[model samples]
Target: MASGKEKPLHSLIAGSTAGAVEAFVTYPAEFVKTRSQFGGQKESPFTIIRSTLASKGITGLYSGCTALVVGNAVKAGVRFVSYDHFKSMLADQQGKVSAPRSLLAGLGAGVMEAVFAVTPSETIKTKLIDDAKRPNPQYRGLVHGTISIVRKEGIRGIYRGLFPVVMRQGANSSVRFTTYTTLKQFVQGNARPGQTIPSSVTFGIGAIAGLVTVYTTMPLDVIKTRMQSLEARQLYRNSFHCAYRIFTEEGLFRFWAGTTPRLARLVMSGGIVFTIYEKIIAVIGGRE
Candidate 1:
Protein backbone atom coordinates (compact mmCIF):
# COMPACT_ATOMS: atom_id res chain seq x y z
CA MET A 1 0.00 0.00 0.00
CA ALA A 2 2.82 2.41 0.70
CA SER A 3 4.00 1.65 -2.80
CA GLY A 4 0.78 2.53 -4.50
CA LYS A 5 0.66 5.72 -6.53
CA GLU A 6 -2.60 7.22 -5.27
CA LYS A 7 -3.26 6.19 -1.68
CA PRO A 8 0.28 6.84 -0.36
CA LEU A 9 0.24 4.03 2.13
CA HIS A 10 3.56 5.06 3.70
CA SER A 11 2.16 8.22 5.20
CA LEU A 12 -0.98 6.54 6.53
CA ILE A 13 0.88 3.56 7.94
CA ALA A 14 3.59 5.67 9.54
CA GLY A 15 1.22 8.20 11.05
CA SER A 16 -1.30 5.68 12.34
CA THR A 17 1.34 3.36 13.77
CA ALA A 18 3.07 6.26 15.48
CA GLY A 19 -0.24 7.41 16.93
CA ALA A 20 -0.89 3.96 18.41
CA VAL A 21 2.53 3.80 20.03
CA GLU A 22 2.25 7.33 21.42
CA ALA A 23 -1.20 6.62 22.83
CA PHE A 24 0.16 3.63 24.70
CA VAL A 25 3.18 5.47 26.07
CA THR A 26 1.32 8.48 27.42
CA TYR A 27 -2.09 7.03 28.19
CA PRO A 28 -1.83 7.43 31.97
CA ALA A 29 -0.78 11.03 31.75
CA GLU A 30 -3.57 11.60 29.30
CA PHE A 31 -6.05 10.19 31.78
CA VAL A 32 -4.87 12.60 34.42
CA LYS A 33 -4.77 15.56 32.07
CA THR A 34 -8.32 14.97 30.89
CA ARG A 35 -9.69 14.69 34.41
CA SER A 36 -8.01 17.94 35.34
CA GLN A 37 -10.24 19.74 32.88
CA PHE A 38 -13.19 19.04 35.17
CA GLY A 39 -11.66 21.68 37.54
CA GLY A 40 -14.29 23.01 40.02
CA GLN A 41 -13.12 20.79 42.87
CA LYS A 42 -9.49 21.20 41.82
CA GLU A 43 -8.29 17.75 42.83
CA SER A 44 -4.52 17.57 42.99
CA PRO A 45 -2.99 15.29 40.35
CA PHE A 46 -1.69 12.90 43.05
CA THR A 47 -5.03 12.76 44.84
CA ILE A 48 -6.81 12.17 41.59
CA ILE A 49 -4.45 9.34 40.73
CA ARG A 50 -4.73 7.71 44.18
CA SER A 51 -8.48 8.02 44.27
CA THR A 52 -8.87 6.73 40.73
CA LEU A 53 -6.71 3.73 41.51
CA ALA A 54 -8.55 3.02 44.73
CA SER A 55 -11.97 3.22 43.10
CA LYS A 56 -11.52 2.17 39.46
CA GLY A 57 -8.14 0.46 39.56
CA ILE A 58 -5.39 0.90 36.93
CA THR A 59 -8.03 0.44 34.22
CA GLY A 60 -9.65 3.76 35.14
CA LEU A 61 -6.48 5.39 33.89
CA TYR A 62 -7.44 4.13 30.46
CA SER A 63 -11.02 5.38 30.58
CA GLY A 64 -11.30 6.66 27.08
CA CYS A 65 -8.55 4.59 25.52
CA THR A 66 -10.75 2.96 22.91
CA ALA A 67 -12.01 6.37 21.85
CA LEU A 68 -8.51 7.80 21.80
CA VAL A 69 -7.16 4.94 19.73
CA VAL A 70 -9.89 4.98 17.11
CA GLY A 71 -9.78 8.77 16.94
CA ASN A 72 -6.00 8.90 16.52
CA ALA A 73 -5.96 6.12 13.99
CA VAL A 74 -8.42 7.99 11.80
CA LYS A 75 -6.55 11.24 12.29
CA ALA A 76 -3.02 9.94 11.59
CA GLY A 77 -4.02 7.59 8.83
CA VAL A 78 -6.01 10.16 6.90
CA ARG A 79 -3.41 12.83 7.52
CA PHE A 80 -0.51 10.81 6.16
CA VAL A 81 -2.36 9.27 3.26
CA SER A 82 -4.21 12.39 2.24
CA TYR A 83 -1.23 14.67 2.68
CA ASP A 84 0.74 12.57 0.20
CA HIS A 85 -2.14 12.28 -2.19
CA PHE A 86 -2.85 16.00 -2.09
CA LYS A 87 0.82 16.91 -2.34
CA SER A 88 1.43 14.57 -5.24
CA MET A 89 -1.60 15.83 -7.07
CA LEU A 90 -0.35 19.35 -6.58
CA ALA A 91 3.10 18.34 -7.70
CA ASP A 92 1.71 17.18 -11.00
CA GLN A 93 0.34 20.65 -11.55
CA GLN A 94 2.94 22.82 -9.77
CA GLY A 95 6.16 21.02 -10.75
CA LYS A 96 6.49 19.33 -7.33
CA VAL A 97 4.57 20.27 -4.21
CA SER A 98 6.32 23.03 -2.31
CA ALA A 99 6.53 23.70 1.45
CA PRO A 100 3.26 25.63 1.30
CA ARG A 101 1.62 22.67 -0.38
CA SER A 102 2.39 20.66 2.68
CA LEU A 103 0.76 23.42 4.65
CA LEU A 104 -2.41 23.21 2.67
CA ALA A 105 -2.33 19.45 2.84
CA GLY A 106 -2.06 19.72 6.59
CA LEU A 107 -5.11 21.96 6.65
CA GLY A 108 -7.03 19.51 4.53
CA ALA A 109 -5.97 16.62 6.68
CA GLY A 110 -7.02 18.48 9.82
CA VAL A 111 -10.50 19.19 8.52
CA MET A 112 -10.84 15.65 7.31
CA GLU A 113 -9.57 14.23 10.55
CA ALA A 114 -12.01 16.36 12.49
CA VAL A 115 -14.87 15.32 10.29
CA PHE A 116 -13.94 11.66 10.07
CA ALA A 117 -12.13 11.19 13.35
CA VAL A 118 -12.00 13.46 16.40
CA THR A 119 -15.64 14.51 16.74
CA PRO A 120 -17.13 11.11 17.39
CA SER A 121 -14.73 9.75 20.01
CA GLU A 122 -14.05 13.06 21.70
CA THR A 123 -17.71 13.69 22.52
CA ILE A 124 -18.48 10.13 23.50
CA LYS A 125 -15.40 9.68 25.65
CA THR A 126 -15.92 12.94 27.51
CA LYS A 127 -19.53 12.15 28.25
CA LEU A 128 -18.68 8.66 29.40
CA ILE A 129 -15.93 9.83 31.72
CA ASP A 130 -17.67 12.96 32.97
CA ASP A 131 -21.03 11.66 34.09
CA ALA A 132 -23.20 14.08 36.07
CA LYS A 133 -22.22 13.65 39.73
CA ARG A 134 -24.44 11.08 41.30
CA PRO A 135 -23.59 8.79 44.21
CA ASN A 136 -22.20 6.15 41.82
CA PRO A 137 -24.85 7.20 39.26
CA GLN A 138 -26.10 4.82 36.62
CA TYR A 139 -23.12 4.32 34.33
CA ARG A 140 -19.45 4.43 35.30
CA GLY A 141 -18.30 2.45 32.31
CA LEU A 142 -17.93 3.63 28.69
CA VAL A 143 -20.52 1.23 27.34
CA HIS A 144 -23.16 2.22 29.87
CA GLY A 145 -22.39 5.88 29.45
CA THR A 146 -22.76 5.65 25.71
CA ILE A 147 -26.14 3.98 25.96
CA SER A 148 -27.38 6.53 28.43
CA ILE A 149 -26.21 9.47 26.33
CA VAL A 150 -27.80 8.06 23.21
CA ARG A 151 -31.09 7.41 24.87
CA LYS A 152 -31.12 10.89 26.39
CA GLU A 153 -29.40 13.02 23.78
CA GLY A 154 -29.84 10.99 20.61
CA ILE A 155 -27.36 10.98 17.66
CA ARG A 156 -26.54 14.68 17.59
CA GLY A 157 -26.15 14.60 21.36
CA ILE A 158 -23.31 12.13 20.99
CA TYR A 159 -21.24 14.71 19.10
CA ARG A 160 -21.13 17.73 21.42
CA GLY A 161 -17.69 19.21 20.72
CA LEU A 162 -17.65 19.08 16.95
CA PHE A 163 -16.94 22.76 16.52
CA PRO A 164 -14.06 22.88 18.96
CA VAL A 165 -12.67 19.61 17.70
CA VAL A 166 -12.71 20.88 14.13
CA MET A 167 -11.15 24.19 15.06
CA ARG A 168 -8.32 22.68 17.13
CA GLN A 169 -7.50 19.69 14.96
CA GLY A 170 -7.59 21.82 11.80
CA ALA A 171 -5.18 24.32 13.28
CA ASN A 172 -3.00 21.50 14.57
CA SER A 173 -2.82 19.75 11.20
CA SER A 174 -2.14 22.95 9.30
CA VAL A 175 0.86 23.74 11.44
CA ARG A 176 2.08 20.18 11.83
CA PHE A 177 1.97 18.98 8.21
CA THR A 178 3.22 22.24 6.75
CA THR A 179 6.08 22.46 9.21
CA TYR A 180 6.97 18.81 8.80
CA THR A 181 7.36 19.05 5.01
CA THR A 182 9.19 22.37 5.18
CA LEU A 183 11.57 21.11 7.85
CA LYS A 184 12.29 17.98 5.86
CA GLN A 185 13.16 20.06 2.82
CA PHE A 186 15.38 22.43 4.79
CA VAL A 187 17.23 19.51 6.34
CA GLN A 188 17.60 17.61 3.10
CA GLY A 189 19.02 20.49 1.10
CA ASN A 190 20.39 19.35 -2.27
CA ALA A 191 21.66 16.01 -1.12
CA ARG A 192 22.60 13.16 -3.47
CA PRO A 193 20.10 12.41 -6.21
CA GLY A 194 18.14 9.83 -4.21
CA GLN A 195 19.60 9.74 -0.75
CA THR A 196 17.02 8.88 1.91
CA ILE A 197 16.12 11.31 4.66
CA PRO A 198 16.51 10.09 8.22
CA SER A 199 13.43 8.93 10.14
CA SER A 200 14.62 10.41 13.41
CA VAL A 201 14.93 13.76 11.72
CA THR A 202 11.50 13.57 10.14
CA PHE A 203 9.79 12.63 13.41
CA GLY A 204 11.62 15.33 15.33
CA ILE A 205 10.27 17.93 12.94
CA GLY A 206 6.77 16.50 13.37
CA ALA A 207 7.09 16.69 17.15
CA ILE A 208 8.06 20.34 17.06
CA ALA A 209 5.20 21.14 14.73
CA GLY A 210 2.70 19.18 16.79
CA LEU A 211 3.77 20.91 20.01
CA VAL A 212 3.24 24.32 18.49
CA THR A 213 -0.22 23.41 17.26
CA VAL A 214 -1.30 21.82 20.52
CA TYR A 215 -0.24 24.80 22.62
CA THR A 216 -1.79 27.34 20.30
CA THR A 217 -5.12 25.55 20.30
CA MET A 218 -5.23 25.18 24.06
CA PRO A 219 -8.21 27.45 24.67
CA LEU A 220 -10.41 25.61 22.26
CA ASP A 221 -9.22 22.29 23.63
CA VAL A 222 -10.16 23.34 27.15
CA ILE A 223 -13.61 24.49 26.14
CA LYS A 224 -14.19 21.27 24.25
CA THR A 225 -13.08 19.29 27.24
CA ARG A 226 -15.57 21.02 29.49
CA MET A 227 -18.33 20.76 26.96
CA GLN A 228 -17.64 17.05 26.86
CA SER A 229 -17.27 16.73 30.63
CA LEU A 230 -19.93 15.74 33.16
CA GLU A 231 -20.00 18.96 35.25
CA ALA A 232 -21.53 20.68 32.27
CA ARG A 233 -24.43 18.36 33.04
CA GLN A 234 -26.85 20.91 34.53
CA LEU A 235 -24.85 23.74 32.96
CA TYR A 236 -26.20 23.32 29.42
CA ARG A 237 -28.51 21.15 27.36
CA ASN A 238 -26.23 19.62 24.73
CA SER A 239 -22.91 20.31 22.96
CA PHE A 240 -24.07 23.38 21.05
CA HIS A 241 -26.11 24.45 23.98
CA CYS A 242 -23.10 23.95 26.23
CA ALA A 243 -20.89 26.15 24.04
CA TYR A 244 -23.46 28.90 23.92
CA ARG A 245 -23.98 28.77 27.68
CA ILE A 246 -20.27 28.83 28.41
CA PHE A 247 -19.79 31.76 26.09
CA THR A 248 -22.67 33.80 27.49
CA GLU A 249 -22.75 32.82 31.15
CA GLU A 250 -19.16 31.95 31.99
CA GLY A 251 -17.61 34.50 29.56
CA LEU A 252 -14.82 33.89 27.02
CA PHE A 253 -12.23 33.29 29.77
CA ARG A 254 -14.28 30.35 30.89
CA PHE A 255 -13.30 28.57 27.70
CA TRP A 256 -9.71 28.45 28.89
CA ALA A 257 -10.41 27.38 32.46
CA GLY A 258 -8.29 24.24 32.29
CA THR A 259 -5.24 25.73 30.61
CA THR A 260 -2.69 24.14 32.91
CA PRO A 261 -3.97 20.62 32.45
CA ARG A 262 -4.11 21.10 28.69
CA LEU A 263 -0.51 22.30 28.64
CA ALA A 264 0.48 19.19 30.55
CA ARG A 265 -1.48 17.19 28.02
CA LEU A 266 0.37 18.84 25.18
CA VAL A 267 3.81 18.30 26.60
CA MET A 268 3.27 14.73 27.75
CA SER A 269 0.77 12.79 25.66
CA GLY A 270 0.81 15.10 22.67
CA GLY A 271 4.59 15.28 22.44
CA ILE A 272 4.83 11.53 22.71
CA VAL A 273 2.24 11.17 19.96
CA PHE A 274 4.30 13.19 17.51
CA THR A 275 7.56 11.41 18.35
CA ILE A 276 6.05 7.95 18.19
CA TYR A 277 4.28 8.80 14.94
CA GLU A 278 7.67 9.25 13.33
CA LYS A 279 9.00 6.05 14.85
CA ILE A 280 6.04 4.11 13.52
CA ILE A 281 6.68 5.45 10.05
CA ALA A 282 10.26 4.20 10.21
CA VAL A 283 9.08 0.81 11.42
CA ILE A 284 6.90 0.44 8.35
CA GLY A 285 9.59 1.47 5.83
CA GLY A 286 8.08 4.87 5.22
CA ARG A 287 9.92 7.82 3.64
CA GLU A 288 9.71 11.54 4.29
Candidate 2:
Protein backbone atom coordinates (compact mmCIF):
# COMPACT_ATOMS: atom_id res chain seq x y z
CA MET A 1 0.00 0.00 0.00
CA ALA A 2 3.06 2.27 0.24
CA SER A 3 2.84 2.44 -3.47
CA GLY A 4 -0.56 4.16 -3.20
CA LYS A 5 0.61 7.76 -2.93
CA GLU A 6 3.76 6.92 -4.81
CA LYS A 7 1.75 5.69 -7.75
CA PRO A 8 -0.60 8.65 -7.78
CA LEU A 9 2.40 10.92 -7.44
CA HIS A 10 3.67 9.36 -10.58
CA SER A 11 0.50 10.55 -12.33
CA LEU A 12 1.42 14.14 -11.56
CA ILE A 13 5.01 13.63 -12.63
CA ALA A 14 4.00 11.74 -15.72
CA GLY A 15 1.44 14.31 -16.67
CA SER A 16 3.86 17.19 -16.26
CA THR A 17 6.72 15.41 -18.00
CA ALA A 18 4.35 14.47 -20.77
CA GLY A 19 3.07 18.00 -20.94
CA ALA A 20 6.52 19.47 -21.52
CA VAL A 21 7.41 17.01 -24.25
CA GLU A 22 4.01 17.38 -25.86
CA ALA A 23 4.26 21.17 -25.88
CA PHE A 24 7.59 21.01 -27.67
CA VAL A 25 6.19 18.68 -30.27
CA THR A 26 3.16 20.82 -31.02
CA TYR A 27 4.76 24.24 -30.64
CA PRO A 28 4.19 25.11 -34.27
CA ALA A 29 0.44 24.82 -33.86
CA GLU A 30 0.71 26.84 -30.69
CA PHE A 31 2.71 29.47 -32.55
CA VAL A 32 -0.02 29.55 -35.14
CA LYS A 33 -2.75 29.88 -32.51
CA THR A 34 -1.00 32.66 -30.64
CA ARG A 35 -0.08 34.57 -33.76
CA SER A 36 -3.61 34.29 -35.01
CA GLN A 37 -4.89 35.86 -31.86
CA PHE A 38 -2.38 38.68 -31.95
CA GLY A 39 -1.47 38.81 -35.61
CA GLY A 40 -4.52 40.91 -36.53
CA GLN A 41 -5.81 41.82 -39.99
CA LYS A 42 -4.27 39.56 -42.65
CA GLU A 43 -3.28 37.04 -40.02
CA SER A 44 -4.55 34.16 -42.09
CA PRO A 45 -3.02 30.68 -41.94
CA PHE A 46 -1.37 30.98 -45.34
CA THR A 47 0.36 34.23 -44.51
CA ILE A 48 1.56 33.20 -41.04
CA ILE A 49 2.78 29.85 -42.34
CA ARG A 50 4.63 31.49 -45.19
CA SER A 51 6.03 34.26 -43.03
CA THR A 52 7.30 31.86 -40.36
CA LEU A 53 8.85 29.39 -42.82
CA ALA A 54 10.43 32.28 -44.76
CA SER A 55 11.75 34.26 -41.80
CA LYS A 56 12.57 31.61 -39.18
CA GLY A 57 12.75 28.41 -41.24
CA ILE A 58 11.56 25.10 -39.80
CA THR A 59 12.72 26.24 -36.39
CA GLY A 60 9.92 28.79 -36.66
CA LEU A 61 7.57 25.95 -35.76
CA TYR A 62 9.18 25.89 -32.36
CA SER A 63 9.62 29.64 -31.86
CA GLY A 64 7.93 29.93 -28.49
CA CYS A 65 8.78 26.38 -27.46
CA THR A 66 10.62 27.21 -24.28
CA ALA A 67 7.78 29.16 -22.72
CA LEU A 68 5.27 26.60 -23.85
CA VAL A 69 7.33 23.81 -22.37
CA VAL A 70 7.53 25.43 -18.95
CA GLY A 71 4.00 26.75 -18.90
CA ASN A 72 2.36 23.53 -19.99
CA ALA A 73 4.57 21.47 -17.70
CA VAL A 74 3.51 23.50 -14.69
CA LYS A 75 -0.09 23.41 -15.85
CA ALA A 76 -0.12 19.65 -16.18
CA GLY A 77 1.56 19.21 -12.81
CA VAL A 78 -0.98 21.35 -11.03
CA ARG A 79 -3.82 19.74 -12.87
CA PHE A 80 -2.78 16.22 -11.88
CA VAL A 81 -2.01 17.23 -8.31
CA SER A 82 -5.23 19.11 -7.99
CA TYR A 83 -7.21 16.33 -9.56
CA ASP A 84 -5.74 13.82 -7.14
CA HIS A 85 -6.66 15.99 -4.21
CA PHE A 86 -10.11 16.75 -5.52
CA LYS A 87 -10.80 13.14 -6.35
CA SER A 88 -10.12 12.29 -2.75
CA MET A 89 -12.48 15.01 -1.65
CA LEU A 90 -15.23 13.68 -3.84
CA ALA A 91 -14.56 10.18 -2.68
CA ASP A 92 -14.78 11.21 0.95
CA GLN A 93 -17.89 13.19 0.32
CA GLN A 94 -19.60 10.20 -1.23
CA GLY A 95 -17.82 7.64 0.95
CA LYS A 96 -16.18 6.19 -2.17
CA VAL A 97 -14.67 7.20 -5.52
CA SER A 98 -16.54 6.64 -8.74
CA ALA A 99 -16.70 7.96 -12.29
CA PRO A 100 -19.05 10.72 -11.20
CA ARG A 101 -16.59 11.49 -8.44
CA SER A 102 -13.94 11.91 -11.07
CA LEU A 103 -16.12 14.43 -12.84
CA LEU A 104 -16.30 16.63 -9.78
CA ALA A 105 -12.63 16.05 -9.16
CA GLY A 106 -11.83 17.16 -12.65
CA LEU A 107 -14.08 20.17 -12.24
CA GLY A 108 -12.36 21.28 -9.06
CA ALA A 109 -8.91 20.75 -10.56
CA GLY A 110 -9.87 22.74 -13.61
CA VAL A 111 -11.20 25.67 -11.58
CA MET A 112 -8.24 25.71 -9.23
CA GLU A 113 -5.72 25.51 -12.04
CA ALA A 114 -7.47 28.33 -13.86
CA VAL A 115 -7.49 30.51 -10.75
CA PHE A 116 -3.82 29.89 -10.08
CA ALA A 117 -2.55 30.27 -13.64
CA VAL A 118 -4.95 32.82 -15.10
CA THR A 119 -2.73 35.87 -15.11
CA PRO A 120 0.80 34.56 -15.42
CA SER A 121 -0.29 31.92 -17.85
CA GLU A 122 -1.98 34.46 -20.08
CA THR A 123 0.86 36.91 -19.71
CA ILE A 124 3.50 34.39 -20.67
CA LYS A 125 1.38 32.96 -23.42
CA THR A 126 0.68 36.44 -24.73
CA LYS A 127 4.28 37.51 -24.53
CA LEU A 128 5.52 34.33 -26.18
CA ILE A 129 2.81 34.17 -28.80
CA ASP A 130 2.80 37.83 -29.64
CA ASP A 131 3.52 38.31 -33.32
CA ALA A 132 7.19 38.99 -33.98
CA LYS A 133 6.08 41.34 -36.69
CA ARG A 134 4.43 43.72 -34.30
CA PRO A 135 6.06 47.13 -34.14
CA ASN A 136 6.77 46.67 -30.44
CA PRO A 137 10.00 44.80 -29.76
CA GLN A 138 10.94 42.80 -26.68
CA TYR A 139 13.37 40.10 -25.49
CA ARG A 140 14.86 37.26 -27.51
CA GLY A 141 13.89 34.25 -25.39
CA LEU A 142 11.05 33.09 -23.14
CA VAL A 143 12.59 34.15 -19.84
CA HIS A 144 13.69 37.44 -21.28
CA GLY A 145 10.24 38.10 -22.70
CA THR A 146 8.54 37.30 -19.39
CA ILE A 147 10.93 39.51 -17.44
CA SER A 148 10.44 42.29 -19.94
CA ILE A 149 6.66 42.14 -19.61
CA VAL A 150 6.84 42.25 -15.81
CA ARG A 151 9.27 45.15 -15.91
CA LYS A 152 7.29 47.14 -18.42
CA GLU A 153 3.72 46.30 -17.40
CA GLY A 154 4.11 45.57 -13.67
CA ILE A 155 2.92 42.49 -11.76
CA ARG A 156 -0.61 42.91 -13.03
CA GLY A 157 0.54 43.21 -16.62
CA ILE A 158 2.35 39.90 -16.37
CA TYR A 159 -1.05 38.28 -15.95
CA ARG A 160 -2.87 40.26 -18.61
CA GLY A 161 -5.50 37.79 -19.82
CA LEU A 162 -6.49 36.38 -16.47
CA PHE A 163 -10.22 36.34 -16.85
CA PRO A 164 -10.81 34.33 -20.01
CA VAL A 165 -7.89 32.10 -19.20
CA VAL A 166 -9.64 30.94 -16.07
CA MET A 167 -12.91 30.29 -17.80
CA ARG A 168 -11.57 28.38 -20.76
CA GLN A 169 -8.81 26.48 -19.05
CA GLY A 170 -10.99 25.63 -16.08
CA ALA A 171 -13.63 24.01 -18.20
CA ASN A 172 -11.12 22.35 -20.46
CA SER A 173 -9.29 20.73 -17.56
CA SER A 174 -12.52 19.76 -15.84
CA VAL A 175 -13.59 17.79 -18.87
CA ARG A 176 -10.17 16.41 -19.63
CA PHE A 177 -9.35 14.85 -16.27
CA THR A 178 -12.89 13.74 -15.66
CA THR A 179 -13.16 12.05 -19.00
CA TYR A 180 -9.78 10.46 -18.61
CA THR A 181 -10.82 8.65 -15.48
CA THR A 182 -14.11 7.60 -16.96
CA LEU A 183 -12.45 6.27 -20.08
CA LYS A 184 -9.84 4.42 -18.07
CA GLN A 185 -12.59 2.68 -16.19
CA PHE A 186 -14.37 1.73 -19.36
CA VAL A 187 -11.20 0.32 -20.80
CA GLN A 188 -10.28 -1.68 -17.73
CA GLY A 189 -13.77 -3.02 -17.39
CA ASN A 190 -13.76 -4.32 -20.91
CA ALA A 191 -10.24 -5.67 -21.00
CA ARG A 192 -9.38 -9.35 -20.53
CA PRO A 193 -6.77 -10.46 -17.95
CA GLY A 194 -4.07 -10.85 -20.55
CA GLN A 195 -5.38 -8.21 -22.89
CA THR A 196 -5.19 -4.44 -22.95
CA ILE A 197 -7.39 -1.76 -24.37
CA PRO A 198 -6.63 -0.47 -27.83
CA SER A 199 -4.76 2.77 -28.23
CA SER A 200 -7.53 3.88 -30.54
CA VAL A 201 -9.99 3.79 -27.67
CA THR A 202 -7.86 6.09 -25.57
CA PHE A 203 -7.22 8.38 -28.49
CA GLY A 204 -10.88 8.53 -29.39
CA ILE A 205 -11.93 9.35 -25.85
CA GLY A 206 -9.25 12.00 -25.51
CA ALA A 207 -10.24 13.57 -28.81
CA ILE A 208 -13.91 13.62 -27.88
CA ALA A 209 -13.11 15.12 -24.53
CA GLY A 210 -10.91 17.71 -26.21
CA LEU A 211 -13.64 18.65 -28.65
CA VAL A 212 -16.15 19.01 -25.86
CA THR A 213 -13.72 21.09 -23.86
CA VAL A 214 -12.98 23.35 -26.80
CA TYR A 215 -16.63 23.92 -27.57
CA THR A 216 -17.69 24.32 -23.95
CA THR A 217 -15.12 26.96 -23.17
CA MET A 218 -14.57 28.35 -26.64
CA PRO A 219 -15.98 31.85 -26.08
CA LEU A 220 -13.79 32.43 -23.05
CA ASP A 221 -10.78 31.07 -24.89
CA VAL A 222 -11.53 33.44 -27.75
CA ILE A 223 -11.65 36.39 -25.40
CA LYS A 224 -8.43 35.21 -23.79
CA THR A 225 -6.80 35.05 -27.20
CA ARG A 226 -7.82 38.60 -28.04
CA MET A 227 -6.96 39.72 -24.56
CA GLN A 228 -3.46 38.27 -24.81
CA SER A 229 -2.88 39.79 -28.23
CA LEU A 230 -4.21 43.17 -27.15
CA GLU A 231 -6.40 42.80 -30.18
CA ALA A 232 -9.41 44.34 -28.52
CA ARG A 233 -9.43 48.06 -27.87
CA GLN A 234 -11.44 47.81 -24.67
CA LEU A 235 -9.36 44.91 -23.38
CA TYR A 236 -6.20 46.80 -24.27
CA ARG A 237 -6.73 50.23 -22.66
CA ASN A 238 -5.98 48.97 -19.16
CA SER A 239 -4.60 45.50 -19.52
CA PHE A 240 -5.05 44.77 -15.85
CA HIS A 241 -8.78 45.28 -16.03
CA CYS A 242 -11.03 42.25 -15.54
CA ALA A 243 -13.22 40.52 -18.14
CA TYR A 244 -16.06 42.80 -17.17
CA ARG A 245 -14.27 45.48 -19.16
CA ILE A 246 -14.94 43.60 -22.36
CA PHE A 247 -18.55 43.09 -21.42
CA THR A 248 -19.06 46.78 -20.66
CA GLU A 249 -17.03 48.28 -23.51
CA GLU A 250 -17.36 45.99 -26.53
CA GLY A 251 -20.38 43.91 -25.56
CA LEU A 252 -20.23 40.15 -25.14
CA PHE A 253 -19.95 39.50 -28.85
CA ARG A 254 -16.51 41.02 -28.88
CA PHE A 255 -15.24 38.30 -26.55
CA TRP A 256 -15.31 35.65 -29.26
CA ALA A 257 -13.54 37.26 -32.17
CA GLY A 258 -11.22 34.36 -32.91
CA THR A 259 -13.03 31.34 -31.54
CA THR A 260 -13.07 29.53 -34.86
CA PRO A 261 -9.32 29.22 -35.11
CA ARG A 262 -8.91 28.62 -31.40
CA LEU A 263 -11.34 25.70 -31.54
CA ALA A 264 -9.62 24.26 -34.56
CA ARG A 265 -6.24 24.48 -32.88
CA LEU A 266 -7.57 22.89 -29.69
CA VAL A 267 -9.01 19.99 -31.65
CA MET A 268 -5.63 18.98 -32.93
CA SER A 269 -3.22 20.24 -30.29
CA GLY A 270 -5.12 19.43 -27.11
CA GLY A 271 -6.48 16.20 -28.52
CA ILE A 272 -3.08 15.08 -29.60
CA VAL A 273 -1.65 15.97 -26.22
CA PHE A 274 -4.32 14.02 -24.39
CA THR A 275 -4.00 10.99 -26.64
CA ILE A 276 -0.22 10.96 -26.65
CA TYR A 277 -0.03 11.46 -22.89
CA GLU A 278 -2.09 8.31 -22.29
CA LYS A 279 -0.18 6.39 -24.91
CA ILE A 280 3.08 7.38 -23.25
CA ILE A 281 1.75 6.15 -19.91
CA ALA A 282 0.89 2.84 -21.50
CA VAL A 283 4.32 2.57 -23.05
CA ILE A 284 6.00 3.42 -19.76
CA GLY A 285 3.90 0.79 -18.02
CA GLY A 286 5.53 -1.86 -20.22
CA ARG A 287 2.70 -2.22 -22.63
CA GLU A 288 4.02 -3.36 -26.00
- lDDT of each prediction vs. the true structure? 0.66, 0.63
For candidate 1, write residues 1-288 as lDDT tens digits: 111243357667767876666666666666676776664666666777898888878887787777677677777778667766766666644235576766777777778888887887778767656653334656666677777778888876667777778777877777766666666667666556567656555556655665676657766777678767755666756557766766776677666655554455555544465566555555665664
**Model 2 whole-model lDDT (C-alpha atoms):** 0.63
Q: State each candidate's clash count.
A: 2, 1
Each model's TM-score, in the order given? 0.78, 0.78
Reference-based TM-score, model 1: 0.78
Candidate 1: C-alpha lDDT: 0.66
Model 2 regions more than 4 Å off: 1-8, 92-100, 115-118, 230-265, 268-288
Off by over 4 Å in 1: 1-11, 44-47, 92-100, 132-137, 190-195, 231-233, 236-288
Candidate 2 per-residue lDDT, tens place, 1-288, comes to 000121355566666876777677656766776676542363676678788888778876666677767777877767767876676566644334576676777777777766665457656766665646555545577778777777867887666666667766767777766666666666666777766556666666666666677666656665676666644544365334535665676567545545555556555555566665565555566211
Best by lDDT: 1
